[model samples]
Target: MRTPPQRGRRQGRTTSRELILGSARKLFAEHGYAATSLREIARDAGVDPAMVHHWFGGKEELFNACVELPADPAQVLGHVGELPAELRGEALLRALLTLWDSPAQPALLALLRNVTGSKAQAALIRQVLFKRMLALAMAGLPGSAAELERRGVLVASQMIGLMVARYLLRAEPLASAGHDELAALIAPVLQHYLTGPLPGTGSAVPGTGHG
Candidate 1:
Protein backbone atom coordinates (compact mmCIF):
# COMPACT_ATOMS: atom_id res chain seq x y z
CA MET A 1 0.00 0.00 0.00
CA ARG A 2 1.01 3.62 -0.58
CA THR A 3 2.19 5.69 2.35
CA PRO A 4 -0.35 7.84 4.22
CA PRO A 5 -0.12 11.60 3.98
CA GLN A 6 1.76 13.44 6.74
CA ARG A 7 -0.05 15.65 9.29
CA GLY A 8 0.89 18.74 11.38
CA ARG A 9 3.54 21.41 10.94
CA ARG A 10 7.23 20.49 10.89
CA GLN A 11 8.24 23.69 12.72
CA GLY A 12 5.75 26.61 12.71
CA ARG A 13 2.84 26.97 15.13
CA THR A 14 0.34 27.44 12.27
CA THR A 15 -0.59 24.43 10.15
CA SER A 16 0.02 24.47 6.39
CA ARG A 17 -3.73 24.01 5.83
CA GLU A 18 -4.64 27.11 7.84
CA LEU A 19 -2.00 29.14 6.03
CA ILE A 20 -3.31 27.97 2.67
CA LEU A 21 -6.89 28.88 3.52
CA GLY A 22 -5.87 32.30 4.87
CA SER A 23 -3.92 33.01 1.71
CA ALA A 24 -6.80 31.85 -0.50
CA ARG A 25 -9.36 34.00 1.32
CA LYS A 26 -7.17 37.06 1.11
CA LEU A 27 -6.31 36.53 -2.56
CA PHE A 28 -9.90 35.75 -3.52
CA ALA A 29 -11.04 38.96 -1.85
CA GLU A 30 -8.31 41.09 -3.37
CA HIS A 31 -8.13 39.68 -6.91
CA GLY A 32 -11.55 37.95 -7.15
CA TYR A 33 -12.01 34.22 -7.77
CA ALA A 34 -11.26 33.98 -11.47
CA ALA A 35 -8.20 36.20 -11.32
CA THR A 36 -6.52 34.34 -8.46
CA SER A 37 -4.66 31.12 -9.18
CA LEU A 38 -3.85 28.11 -7.01
CA ARG A 39 -0.15 28.62 -7.53
CA GLU A 40 -0.42 32.25 -6.50
CA ILE A 41 -2.22 31.32 -3.30
CA ALA A 42 0.43 28.71 -2.53
CA ARG A 43 3.25 31.18 -3.11
CA ASP A 44 1.71 33.77 -0.83
CA ALA A 45 1.15 31.14 1.88
CA GLY A 46 4.78 29.93 1.54
CA VAL A 47 3.64 26.41 0.73
CA ASP A 48 3.96 24.19 -2.33
CA PRO A 49 1.02 24.35 -4.76
CA ALA A 50 0.36 20.64 -4.17
CA MET A 51 -0.51 21.47 -0.55
CA VAL A 52 -3.56 23.40 -1.75
CA HIS A 53 -4.89 20.32 -3.53
CA HIS A 54 -4.15 18.22 -0.47
CA TRP A 55 -5.84 20.66 1.93
CA PHE A 56 -8.76 21.51 -0.38
CA GLY A 57 -9.82 19.49 -3.43
CA GLY A 58 -9.85 22.48 -5.73
CA LYS A 59 -10.40 26.22 -5.98
CA GLU A 60 -14.19 25.84 -5.97
CA GLU A 61 -14.18 23.87 -2.75
CA LEU A 62 -11.77 26.35 -1.21
CA PHE A 63 -14.03 29.21 -2.25
CA ASN A 64 -17.05 27.47 -0.78
CA ALA A 65 -15.21 26.92 2.46
CA CYS A 66 -14.09 30.52 2.60
CA VAL A 67 -17.57 31.85 1.81
CA GLU A 68 -19.74 29.63 3.92
CA LEU A 69 -23.38 30.69 3.65
CA PRO A 70 -25.67 30.81 6.66
CA ALA A 71 -28.34 28.90 4.73
CA ASP A 72 -28.28 25.86 2.50
CA PRO A 73 -29.46 26.43 -1.10
CA ALA A 74 -31.34 23.14 -1.23
CA GLN A 75 -33.08 23.86 2.05
CA VAL A 76 -34.00 27.36 0.97
CA LEU A 77 -35.69 25.97 -2.16
CA GLY A 78 -37.58 23.37 -0.12
CA HIS A 79 -40.66 25.58 0.27
CA VAL A 80 -41.16 25.77 -3.49
CA GLY A 81 -42.44 22.21 -3.65
CA GLU A 82 -44.53 22.41 -0.48
CA LEU A 83 -46.68 25.37 -1.51
CA PRO A 84 -49.62 25.15 -3.88
CA ALA A 85 -48.45 25.55 -7.46
CA GLU A 86 -50.16 28.91 -7.80
CA LEU A 87 -48.50 30.13 -4.61
CA ARG A 88 -45.10 28.60 -5.16
CA GLY A 89 -43.84 31.57 -7.12
CA GLU A 90 -44.81 34.06 -4.46
CA ALA A 91 -43.41 31.82 -1.76
CA LEU A 92 -40.06 31.60 -3.55
CA LEU A 93 -39.85 35.37 -3.92
CA ARG A 94 -40.77 35.95 -0.30
CA ALA A 95 -38.23 33.40 0.86
CA LEU A 96 -35.45 34.97 -1.15
CA LEU A 97 -36.34 38.46 0.03
CA THR A 98 -36.49 37.32 3.63
CA LEU A 99 -33.04 35.76 3.24
CA TRP A 100 -31.67 39.03 1.92
CA ASP A 101 -33.27 40.88 4.79
CA SER A 102 -31.81 38.52 7.38
CA PRO A 103 -28.50 38.70 9.22
CA ALA A 104 -27.19 36.53 6.39
CA GLN A 105 -27.53 39.55 4.10
CA PRO A 106 -23.88 40.52 4.48
CA ALA A 107 -22.69 37.11 3.34
CA LEU A 108 -25.14 37.11 0.45
CA LEU A 109 -23.97 40.58 -0.54
CA ALA A 110 -20.37 39.47 -0.44
CA LEU A 111 -21.20 36.52 -2.66
CA LEU A 112 -22.89 38.78 -5.16
CA ARG A 113 -19.97 41.17 -5.08
CA ASN A 114 -17.57 38.32 -5.79
CA VAL A 115 -19.79 37.04 -8.61
CA THR A 116 -19.78 40.47 -10.22
CA GLY A 117 -16.05 40.74 -9.80
CA SER A 118 -15.13 37.40 -11.37
CA LYS A 119 -16.36 35.20 -14.20
CA ALA A 120 -15.35 32.06 -12.29
CA GLN A 121 -17.48 33.13 -9.36
CA ALA A 122 -20.40 33.75 -11.73
CA ALA A 123 -19.97 30.24 -13.16
CA LEU A 124 -20.08 28.77 -9.65
CA ILE A 125 -23.30 30.69 -8.92
CA ARG A 126 -24.80 29.41 -12.16
CA GLN A 127 -23.87 25.83 -11.30
CA VAL A 128 -25.44 26.09 -7.84
CA LEU A 129 -28.57 27.81 -9.14
CA PHE A 130 -29.14 25.52 -12.09
CA LYS A 131 -27.91 22.22 -10.73
CA ARG A 132 -29.13 22.54 -7.17
CA MET A 133 -31.68 25.33 -6.67
CA LEU A 134 -33.54 25.30 -9.98
CA ALA A 135 -33.33 21.54 -10.29
CA LEU A 136 -35.06 21.22 -6.92
CA ALA A 137 -37.59 23.93 -7.80
CA MET A 138 -38.39 22.32 -11.13
CA ALA A 139 -39.12 18.97 -9.61
CA GLY A 140 -42.73 17.79 -10.26
CA LEU A 141 -43.42 20.83 -12.46
CA PRO A 142 -45.20 20.25 -15.77
CA GLY A 143 -43.18 20.31 -18.99
CA SER A 144 -40.83 18.48 -21.33
CA ALA A 145 -37.15 18.59 -20.29
CA ALA A 146 -36.48 21.38 -22.80
CA GLU A 147 -39.49 23.34 -21.64
CA LEU A 148 -38.48 22.91 -18.02
CA GLU A 149 -34.99 24.18 -18.78
CA ARG A 150 -36.34 27.22 -20.60
CA ARG A 151 -38.68 28.07 -17.74
CA GLY A 152 -35.91 27.60 -15.21
CA VAL A 153 -33.66 29.96 -17.14
CA LEU A 154 -36.42 32.58 -17.22
CA VAL A 155 -36.95 32.28 -13.49
CA ALA A 156 -33.24 32.56 -12.78
CA SER A 157 -33.03 35.62 -15.00
CA GLN A 158 -35.87 37.28 -13.14
CA MET A 159 -34.44 36.47 -9.72
CA ILE A 160 -30.95 37.66 -10.67
CA GLY A 161 -32.35 40.91 -12.08
CA LEU A 162 -34.32 41.48 -8.90
CA MET A 163 -31.24 40.84 -6.77
CA VAL A 164 -29.13 43.25 -8.79
CA ALA A 165 -31.77 45.97 -8.62
CA ARG A 166 -32.91 45.60 -5.04
CA TYR A 167 -29.80 44.42 -3.24
CA LEU A 168 -26.73 45.32 -5.28
CA LEU A 169 -27.36 48.58 -7.11
CA ARG A 170 -30.19 49.54 -4.73
CA ALA A 171 -32.47 50.73 -7.51
CA GLU A 172 -35.28 53.10 -6.52
CA PRO A 173 -38.78 51.71 -5.99
CA LEU A 174 -37.67 48.09 -5.80
CA ALA A 175 -35.08 48.88 -3.14
CA SER A 176 -37.73 50.58 -1.03
CA ALA A 177 -40.50 48.06 -1.74
CA GLY A 178 -41.87 45.97 1.12
CA HIS A 179 -41.36 42.23 1.00
CA ASP A 180 -45.06 41.38 0.62
CA GLU A 181 -45.52 44.05 -2.03
CA LEU A 182 -42.55 42.83 -4.00
CA ALA A 183 -43.76 39.25 -3.75
CA ALA A 184 -47.20 40.22 -5.00
CA LEU A 185 -45.71 42.00 -7.97
CA ILE A 186 -43.00 39.46 -8.88
CA ALA A 187 -44.78 36.20 -8.22
CA PRO A 188 -46.92 36.15 -11.33
CA VAL A 189 -43.93 36.12 -13.66
CA LEU A 190 -42.38 33.31 -11.70
CA GLN A 191 -45.68 31.45 -11.80
CA HIS A 192 -45.67 31.89 -15.54
CA TYR A 193 -42.27 30.30 -15.68
CA LEU A 194 -43.36 27.47 -13.44
CA THR A 195 -46.67 26.52 -15.11
CA GLY A 196 -47.99 29.16 -17.46
CA PRO A 197 -47.83 28.89 -21.28
CA LEU A 198 -44.88 30.09 -23.32
CA PRO A 199 -45.35 32.14 -26.52
CA GLY A 200 -45.17 29.11 -28.86
CA THR A 201 -46.27 26.35 -26.51
CA GLY A 202 -49.75 25.17 -25.61
CA SER A 203 -51.14 26.14 -22.22
CA ALA A 204 -50.05 24.01 -19.29
CA VAL A 205 -52.53 23.16 -16.60
CA PRO A 206 -51.46 24.27 -13.14
CA GLY A 207 -50.24 21.58 -10.74
CA THR A 208 -49.84 18.95 -13.46
CA GLY A 209 -46.78 16.67 -13.39
CA HIS A 210 -46.50 17.03 -9.62
CA GLY A 211 -45.17 13.97 -7.85
Candidate 2:
Protein backbone atom coordinates (compact mmCIF):
# COMPACT_ATOMS: atom_id res chain seq x y z
CA MET A 1 0.00 0.00 0.00
CA ARG A 2 1.25 3.52 -0.78
CA THR A 3 2.01 5.65 2.28
CA PRO A 4 0.14 8.96 2.42
CA PRO A 5 2.16 12.07 1.70
CA GLN A 6 3.06 14.19 4.72
CA ARG A 7 1.84 17.78 4.84
CA GLY A 8 4.46 20.54 4.82
CA ARG A 9 5.49 22.15 8.16
CA ARG A 10 2.91 24.99 7.89
CA GLN A 11 0.11 22.43 7.56
CA GLY A 12 1.68 20.06 10.11
CA ARG A 13 -0.04 21.62 13.14
CA THR A 14 -3.51 20.85 11.71
CA THR A 15 -5.04 17.62 12.99
CA SER A 16 -6.19 15.00 10.53
CA ARG A 17 -9.87 15.38 11.46
CA GLU A 18 -9.80 19.15 11.24
CA LEU A 19 -7.87 18.94 7.99
CA ILE A 20 -10.40 16.59 6.48
CA LEU A 21 -13.35 18.79 7.43
CA GLY A 22 -11.67 21.96 6.17
CA SER A 23 -10.73 20.34 2.87
CA ALA A 24 -14.18 18.85 2.45
CA ARG A 25 -15.82 22.20 3.12
CA LYS A 26 -13.69 23.93 0.52
CA LEU A 27 -14.09 21.22 -2.10
CA PHE A 28 -17.80 20.93 -1.50
CA ALA A 29 -18.05 24.68 -1.81
CA GLU A 30 -15.86 25.01 -4.91
CA HIS A 31 -17.05 21.89 -6.66
CA GLY A 32 -20.54 20.51 -6.49
CA TYR A 33 -21.30 18.03 -3.68
CA ALA A 34 -21.57 15.09 -6.08
CA ALA A 35 -18.18 15.85 -7.60
CA THR A 36 -16.30 15.97 -4.32
CA SER A 37 -14.75 12.69 -3.09
CA LEU A 38 -13.45 11.33 0.19
CA ARG A 39 -10.14 10.42 -1.46
CA GLU A 40 -9.69 13.97 -2.65
CA ILE A 41 -10.53 15.27 0.80
CA ALA A 42 -8.05 12.90 2.39
CA ARG A 43 -5.35 13.96 -0.05
CA ASP A 44 -6.02 17.65 0.60
CA ALA A 45 -5.96 17.00 4.34
CA GLY A 46 -2.64 15.17 3.93
CA VAL A 47 -3.99 12.05 5.59
CA ASP A 48 -4.56 8.46 4.56
CA PRO A 49 -7.97 7.89 2.96
CA ALA A 50 -8.82 5.53 5.79
CA MET A 51 -8.76 8.39 8.27
CA VAL A 52 -11.78 9.96 6.57
CA HIS A 53 -13.80 6.78 7.05
CA HIS A 54 -12.59 6.48 10.62
CA TRP A 55 -13.91 9.96 11.49
CA PHE A 56 -17.03 10.20 9.35
CA GLY A 57 -19.06 7.09 8.52
CA GLY A 58 -19.58 8.16 4.92
CA LYS A 59 -19.87 11.05 2.54
CA GLU A 60 -23.46 11.84 3.49
CA GLU A 61 -22.63 12.08 7.16
CA LEU A 62 -19.74 14.37 6.36
CA PHE A 63 -22.04 16.47 4.20
CA ASN A 64 -24.43 16.89 7.12
CA ALA A 65 -21.61 18.07 9.33
CA CYS A 66 -20.43 20.43 6.60
CA VAL A 67 -23.88 21.93 6.27
CA GLU A 68 -23.98 22.78 10.02
CA LEU A 69 -27.65 22.23 10.52
CA PRO A 70 -28.53 22.61 14.19
CA ALA A 71 -31.18 20.28 15.56
CA ASP A 72 -33.53 18.81 12.98
CA PRO A 73 -36.03 21.53 12.06
CA ALA A 74 -38.96 19.41 13.06
CA GLN A 75 -37.44 18.86 16.44
CA VAL A 76 -36.65 22.53 16.75
CA LEU A 77 -40.15 23.53 15.70
CA GLY A 78 -41.81 21.02 17.97
CA HIS A 79 -40.63 22.79 21.07
CA VAL A 80 -42.95 25.68 20.25
CA GLY A 81 -45.85 23.34 19.59
CA GLU A 82 -47.82 24.72 22.49
CA LEU A 83 -47.71 28.33 21.29
CA PRO A 84 -51.14 29.73 20.44
CA ALA A 85 -52.11 29.99 16.80
CA GLU A 86 -52.37 33.80 16.82
CA LEU A 87 -48.86 34.13 18.18
CA ARG A 88 -47.23 31.23 16.41
CA GLY A 89 -45.88 33.20 13.47
CA GLU A 90 -44.18 35.84 15.54
CA ALA A 91 -43.03 33.23 17.98
CA LEU A 92 -41.58 31.01 15.31
CA LEU A 93 -39.75 33.82 13.56
CA ARG A 94 -38.54 35.13 16.87
CA ALA A 95 -37.06 31.76 17.71
CA LEU A 96 -35.49 31.48 14.27
CA LEU A 97 -33.96 34.92 14.34
CA THR A 98 -32.60 34.25 17.79
CA LEU A 99 -30.95 31.10 16.53
CA TRP A 100 -29.66 32.83 13.42
CA ASP A 101 -28.11 35.60 15.50
CA SER A 102 -26.34 33.20 17.80
CA PRO A 103 -22.81 31.89 17.23
CA ALA A 104 -24.31 29.09 15.17
CA GLN A 105 -25.28 31.59 12.48
CA PRO A 106 -21.72 32.00 11.19
CA ALA A 107 -21.45 28.29 10.52
CA LEU A 108 -24.89 28.38 8.92
CA LEU A 109 -23.85 31.28 6.71
CA ALA A 110 -20.80 29.34 5.57
CA LEU A 111 -22.92 26.27 4.89
CA LEU A 112 -25.46 28.29 2.90
CA ARG A 113 -22.84 30.22 0.95
CA ASN A 114 -21.20 26.96 0.00
CA VAL A 115 -24.53 25.49 -1.00
CA THR A 116 -25.35 28.46 -3.21
CA GLY A 117 -22.21 27.93 -5.25
CA SER A 118 -23.48 25.03 -7.36
CA LYS A 119 -26.49 23.15 -8.70
CA ALA A 120 -25.83 20.23 -6.38
CA GLN A 121 -25.83 22.60 -3.43
CA ALA A 122 -29.14 24.06 -4.56
CA ALA A 123 -30.67 20.59 -4.78
CA LEU A 124 -29.31 19.71 -1.36
CA ILE A 125 -30.74 22.89 0.13
CA ARG A 126 -34.10 22.05 -1.40
CA GLN A 127 -34.04 18.64 0.19
CA VAL A 128 -32.94 19.83 3.60
CA LEU A 129 -34.83 23.08 3.97
CA PHE A 130 -37.90 22.57 1.85
CA LYS A 131 -38.53 18.86 1.86
CA ARG A 132 -37.24 17.86 5.25
CA MET A 133 -37.58 20.82 7.60
CA LEU A 134 -40.43 22.79 6.12
CA ALA A 135 -42.34 19.76 4.93
CA LEU A 136 -42.33 18.30 8.42
CA ALA A 137 -43.51 21.59 9.88
CA MET A 138 -46.39 21.65 7.42
CA ALA A 139 -47.38 18.08 8.13
CA GLY A 140 -47.71 18.87 11.81
CA LEU A 141 -50.14 21.66 11.07
CA PRO A 142 -53.85 21.03 10.64
CA GLY A 143 -54.41 21.98 7.01
CA SER A 144 -54.64 20.71 3.45
CA ALA A 145 -51.40 19.51 1.92
CA ALA A 146 -51.69 22.19 -0.76
CA GLU A 147 -52.13 24.84 1.88
CA LEU A 148 -49.22 23.53 3.91
CA GLU A 149 -46.92 23.31 0.91
CA ARG A 150 -47.82 26.77 -0.37
CA ARG A 151 -47.36 28.35 3.03
CA GLY A 152 -44.07 26.60 3.54
CA VAL A 153 -42.83 27.86 0.16
CA LEU A 154 -43.82 31.40 1.01
CA VAL A 155 -42.10 31.30 4.41
CA ALA A 156 -38.97 29.95 2.77
CA SER A 157 -39.06 32.64 0.10
CA GLN A 158 -39.24 35.38 2.70
CA MET A 159 -36.46 33.89 4.80
CA ILE A 160 -34.23 33.41 1.75
CA GLY A 161 -34.78 37.01 0.67
CA LEU A 162 -33.98 38.19 4.18
CA MET A 163 -30.78 36.17 4.26
CA VAL A 164 -29.73 37.48 0.87
CA ALA A 165 -30.41 41.05 1.85
CA ARG A 166 -28.91 40.80 5.30
CA TYR A 167 -25.84 38.73 4.50
CA LEU A 168 -25.05 38.43 0.81
CA LEU A 169 -26.15 41.73 -0.73
CA ARG A 170 -25.87 43.47 2.64
CA ALA A 171 -28.71 45.86 2.05
CA GLU A 172 -27.90 48.77 4.29
CA PRO A 173 -31.07 49.21 6.35
CA LEU A 174 -31.88 45.57 6.85
CA ALA A 175 -28.27 44.58 7.25
CA SER A 176 -27.89 47.03 10.07
CA ALA A 177 -31.20 46.32 11.72
CA GLY A 178 -31.34 44.63 15.14
CA HIS A 179 -32.61 41.06 15.16
CA ASP A 180 -35.65 41.96 17.23
CA GLU A 181 -36.60 44.78 14.88
CA LEU A 182 -36.06 42.55 11.92
CA ALA A 183 -38.22 39.88 13.47
CA ALA A 184 -41.00 42.36 14.11
CA LEU A 185 -40.84 43.57 10.57
CA ILE A 186 -40.82 40.08 9.12
CA ALA A 187 -43.23 38.22 11.39
CA PRO A 188 -46.43 39.69 9.94
CA VAL A 189 -45.54 38.61 6.45
CA LEU A 190 -44.70 35.20 7.79
CA GLN A 191 -47.98 35.11 9.67
CA HIS A 192 -49.79 35.94 6.47
CA TYR A 193 -48.10 33.11 4.67
CA LEU A 194 -48.74 30.56 7.38
CA THR A 195 -52.43 31.14 7.95
CA GLY A 196 -53.59 33.31 5.12
CA PRO A 197 -56.30 32.18 2.71
CA LEU A 198 -55.44 30.77 -0.68
CA PRO A 199 -55.49 33.45 -3.37
CA GLY A 200 -58.68 32.05 -4.98
CA THR A 201 -60.43 31.63 -1.66
CA GLY A 202 -62.26 34.95 -2.11
CA SER A 203 -61.45 36.04 1.39
CA ALA A 204 -58.63 37.56 3.38
CA VAL A 205 -56.24 34.92 4.63
CA PRO A 206 -57.37 33.38 7.91
CA GLY A 207 -55.26 35.40 10.32
CA THR A 208 -55.99 38.59 8.42
CA GLY A 209 -59.77 38.27 8.45
CA HIS A 210 -61.55 41.23 10.06
CA GLY A 211 -63.81 38.88 11.99
Candidate 3:
Protein backbone atom coordinates (compact mmCIF):
# COMPACT_ATOMS: atom_id res chain seq x y z
CA MET A 1 0.00 0.00 0.00
CA ARG A 2 1.19 3.49 -0.82
CA THR A 3 2.24 5.46 2.23
CA PRO A 4 -0.33 8.08 3.29
CA PRO A 5 0.74 11.62 2.57
CA GLN A 6 1.63 13.68 5.64
CA ARG A 7 -0.75 16.58 6.33
CA GLY A 8 0.82 20.00 6.70
CA ARG A 9 0.92 21.36 10.23
CA ARG A 10 -1.84 23.88 10.98
CA GLN A 11 -0.27 27.33 10.44
CA GLY A 12 -2.39 28.83 13.20
CA ARG A 13 -2.44 32.26 11.52
CA THR A 14 -6.13 32.75 12.10
CA THR A 15 -5.69 31.62 15.68
CA SER A 16 -3.15 34.35 16.21
CA ARG A 17 -5.52 37.00 14.92
CA GLU A 18 -8.34 35.75 17.12
CA LEU A 19 -6.04 35.67 20.10
CA ILE A 20 -5.00 39.26 19.50
CA LEU A 21 -8.58 40.46 19.16
CA GLY A 22 -9.72 38.51 22.19
CA SER A 23 -6.92 39.92 24.27
CA ALA A 24 -7.63 43.39 22.98
CA ARG A 25 -11.31 43.17 23.89
CA LYS A 26 -10.62 41.89 27.37
CA LEU A 27 -7.91 44.44 28.07
CA PHE A 28 -9.94 47.26 26.62
CA ALA A 29 -12.91 46.32 28.78
CA GLU A 30 -10.83 45.88 31.88
CA HIS A 31 -8.18 48.58 31.65
CA GLY A 32 -9.93 51.10 29.38
CA TYR A 33 -8.64 52.04 25.92
CA ALA A 34 -5.75 54.43 26.58
CA ALA A 35 -4.16 52.33 29.27
CA THR A 36 -4.16 49.15 27.20
CA SER A 37 -1.20 49.12 24.87
CA LEU A 38 -0.47 46.95 21.87
CA ARG A 39 2.47 45.33 23.64
CA GLU A 40 0.32 44.38 26.58
CA ILE A 41 -2.30 42.85 24.32
CA ALA A 42 0.33 40.91 22.41
CA ARG A 43 1.84 39.65 25.64
CA ASP A 44 -1.58 38.60 26.90
CA ALA A 45 -2.16 36.77 23.65
CA GLY A 46 1.31 35.15 23.70
CA VAL A 47 2.14 36.84 20.43
CA ASP A 48 4.81 39.33 19.41
CA PRO A 49 4.03 43.06 19.60
CA ALA A 50 4.66 43.30 15.89
CA MET A 51 1.82 40.88 15.31
CA VAL A 52 -0.67 43.38 16.71
CA HIS A 53 0.54 46.17 14.47
CA HIS A 54 0.49 43.75 11.56
CA TRP A 55 -3.04 42.69 12.35
CA PHE A 56 -4.60 46.00 13.36
CA GLY A 57 -2.25 48.74 12.12
CA GLY A 58 -2.31 50.67 15.44
CA LYS A 59 -3.96 51.04 18.82
CA GLU A 60 -6.79 53.19 17.44
CA GLU A 61 -7.60 50.66 14.74
CA LEU A 62 -7.33 47.82 17.23
CA PHE A 63 -9.72 49.58 19.60
CA ASN A 64 -12.17 50.10 16.77
CA ALA A 65 -11.95 46.46 15.78
CA CYS A 66 -12.36 45.27 19.37
CA VAL A 67 -15.21 47.55 20.33
CA GLU A 68 -18.01 45.85 18.47
CA LEU A 69 -21.50 47.13 19.27
CA PRO A 70 -24.52 44.87 19.51
CA ALA A 71 -26.42 46.99 17.02
CA ASP A 72 -25.72 49.05 13.94
CA PRO A 73 -25.76 52.67 15.09
CA ALA A 74 -26.56 53.87 11.62
CA GLN A 75 -29.66 51.72 11.44
CA VAL A 76 -30.70 52.59 14.99
CA LEU A 77 -30.44 56.29 14.22
CA GLY A 78 -31.80 55.98 10.69
CA HIS A 79 -35.40 56.38 11.80
CA VAL A 80 -34.52 59.73 13.33
CA GLY A 81 -33.09 60.71 9.99
CA GLU A 82 -36.28 59.62 8.28
CA LEU A 83 -38.52 61.74 10.51
CA PRO A 84 -39.23 65.40 9.86
CA ALA A 85 -36.29 67.51 11.07
CA GLU A 86 -38.40 68.97 13.86
CA LEU A 87 -39.32 65.52 15.05
CA ARG A 88 -35.90 63.93 14.71
CA GLY A 89 -34.48 64.93 18.09
CA GLU A 90 -37.09 63.29 20.30
CA ALA A 91 -37.12 60.21 18.10
CA LEU A 92 -33.36 60.05 18.22
CA LEU A 93 -33.30 60.41 22.00
CA ARG A 94 -36.03 57.79 22.42
CA ALA A 95 -34.31 55.42 20.06
CA LEU A 96 -30.96 55.87 21.85
CA LEU A 97 -32.47 55.25 25.28
CA THR A 98 -34.36 52.21 24.02
CA LEU A 99 -31.14 50.77 22.62
CA TRP A 100 -29.29 51.18 25.91
CA ASP A 101 -32.21 49.66 27.80
CA SER A 102 -32.27 46.64 25.52
CA PRO A 103 -30.23 43.44 25.81
CA ALA A 104 -27.26 45.38 24.49
CA GLN A 105 -27.05 47.36 27.72
CA PRO A 106 -24.04 45.48 28.99
CA ALA A 107 -22.01 46.09 25.87
CA LEU A 108 -23.11 49.70 25.70
CA LEU A 109 -22.13 50.11 29.32
CA ALA A 110 -18.80 48.50 28.69
CA LEU A 111 -18.05 50.91 25.86
CA LEU A 112 -19.06 53.82 28.05
CA ARG A 113 -16.94 52.58 30.92
CA ASN A 114 -13.97 52.26 28.66
CA VAL A 115 -14.57 55.73 27.32
CA THR A 116 -14.77 57.25 30.78
CA GLY A 117 -11.64 55.55 32.00
CA SER A 118 -9.25 56.64 29.30
CA LYS A 119 -8.74 59.79 27.27
CA ALA A 120 -7.45 57.75 24.34
CA GLN A 121 -10.53 55.62 24.44
CA ALA A 122 -12.62 58.77 24.77
CA ALA A 123 -11.05 60.12 21.58
CA LEU A 124 -11.70 56.86 19.80
CA ILE A 125 -15.31 56.92 20.95
CA ARG A 126 -15.73 60.45 19.62
CA GLN A 127 -14.32 59.44 16.24
CA VAL A 128 -16.62 56.46 15.98
CA LEU A 129 -19.66 58.45 17.10
CA PHE A 130 -19.03 61.28 14.69
CA LYS A 131 -18.19 59.05 11.76
CA ARG A 132 -20.87 56.45 12.27
CA MET A 133 -23.69 57.94 14.34
CA LEU A 134 -23.73 61.73 14.36
CA ALA A 135 -22.88 62.14 10.70
CA LEU A 136 -25.88 60.08 9.71
CA ALA A 137 -28.08 61.72 12.32
CA MET A 138 -27.13 65.17 11.09
CA ALA A 139 -27.56 64.46 7.42
CA GLY A 140 -29.69 67.01 5.48
CA LEU A 141 -30.12 69.32 8.50
CA PRO A 142 -29.86 72.98 7.68
CA GLY A 143 -26.73 74.74 8.92
CA SER A 144 -23.29 76.07 8.08
CA ALA A 145 -20.46 73.59 8.63
CA ALA A 146 -19.48 75.30 11.89
CA GLU A 147 -23.09 75.35 13.08
CA LEU A 148 -23.53 71.72 12.21
CA GLU A 149 -20.37 70.75 14.07
CA ARG A 150 -21.48 72.62 17.16
CA ARG A 151 -24.89 70.99 17.06
CA GLY A 152 -23.47 67.51 16.67
CA VAL A 153 -21.10 68.10 19.58
CA LEU A 154 -23.91 69.28 21.81
CA VAL A 155 -26.11 66.33 20.93
CA ALA A 156 -23.31 63.89 21.64
CA SER A 157 -22.51 65.54 24.96
CA GLN A 158 -26.11 65.19 26.08
CA MET A 159 -26.33 61.55 25.12
CA ILE A 160 -23.00 60.69 26.68
CA GLY A 161 -23.84 62.49 29.89
CA LEU A 162 -27.16 60.66 30.09
CA MET A 163 -25.48 57.31 29.55
CA VAL A 164 -22.96 58.03 32.26
CA ALA A 165 -25.63 59.10 34.69
CA ARG A 166 -28.30 56.49 34.07
CA TYR A 167 -26.26 53.43 33.17
CA LEU A 168 -22.75 53.71 34.55
CA LEU A 169 -23.34 55.68 37.70
CA ARG A 170 -26.81 54.13 38.08
CA ALA A 171 -28.20 57.40 39.36
CA GLU A 172 -31.63 56.99 40.93
CA PRO A 173 -34.74 57.91 39.03
CA LEU A 174 -32.95 58.04 35.71
CA ALA A 175 -31.59 54.57 36.29
CA SER A 176 -34.97 53.21 37.23
CA ALA A 177 -37.05 55.27 34.85
CA GLY A 178 -38.51 53.73 31.72
CA HIS A 179 -37.17 54.70 28.31
CA ASP A 180 -40.14 56.80 27.32
CA GLU A 181 -40.04 58.69 30.59
CA LEU A 182 -36.38 59.44 30.21
CA ALA A 183 -36.84 60.36 26.57
CA ALA A 184 -39.66 62.74 27.40
CA LEU A 185 -37.45 64.51 29.88
CA ILE A 186 -34.38 64.67 27.68
CA ALA A 187 -35.66 64.95 24.12
CA PRO A 188 -36.40 68.67 24.16
CA VAL A 189 -32.81 69.46 25.08
CA LEU A 190 -31.59 67.29 22.27
CA GLN A 191 -34.08 68.94 19.92
CA HIS A 192 -32.58 72.27 20.83
CA TYR A 193 -29.15 70.91 20.08
CA LEU A 194 -30.30 69.52 16.76
CA THR A 195 -32.11 72.58 15.39
CA GLY A 196 -32.08 75.38 17.93
CA PRO A 197 -30.57 78.81 17.41
CA LEU A 198 -26.84 79.18 17.71
CA PRO A 199 -25.14 81.79 19.88
CA GLY A 200 -24.11 84.33 17.24
CA THR A 201 -25.89 83.22 14.07
CA GLY A 202 -28.81 85.51 13.29
CA SER A 203 -30.18 83.21 10.61
CA ALA A 204 -33.39 81.41 11.51
CA VAL A 205 -33.68 77.69 10.83
CA PRO A 206 -37.04 76.54 9.44
CA GLY A 207 -38.89 73.74 11.22
CA THR A 208 -36.82 74.41 14.34
CA GLY A 209 -37.98 75.31 17.87
CA HIS A 210 -41.50 74.17 16.99
CA GLY A 211 -41.77 71.39 19.49
Q: Specify the highest-lDDT model's number.
A: 3
The runs of at least 3 residues in candidate 2 whose Cα sits more than 4 Å from the true structure, single-residue gaps closed, are: 1-63, 70-75, 201-211
Tens digits of per-residue lDDT for model 2, 1-211: 3333355543543466688888887777666567889999889988788878877779877767766675456556665556665566776776666767777777778766867676656666665676666654454666777777878898889988888788778898998898778877998888778776658544865563676
Measured with C-alpha atoms, the lDDT of residue 60 in candidate 1 is 72
Give the poorly placed runs of model 1, Cα more than 4 Å off: 1-67, 203-211
Q: Write the per-residue lDDT of candidate 3 for residues 43-161, one digit (tens) a residue.
A: 99998888788877898778768766667766788777777889988888888888987899998888877777766566556666865588778888988888888899999989988
State the lDDT of candidate 1 residue by residue for 8-47, as single tens digits: 4353434777788888777776666678899999999988
**Model 3 misplacement above 4 A:** 1-11, 14-64, 203-211
How far off is residue 71 in model 3, in Å? Answer: 1.5
RMSD of 1: 8.4
Q: Rank the candidates by lDDT, best first.
A: 3, 1, 2
Between candidates 1 and 2, the lDDT winner: 1
Model 3 TM-score, all chains together? 0.68
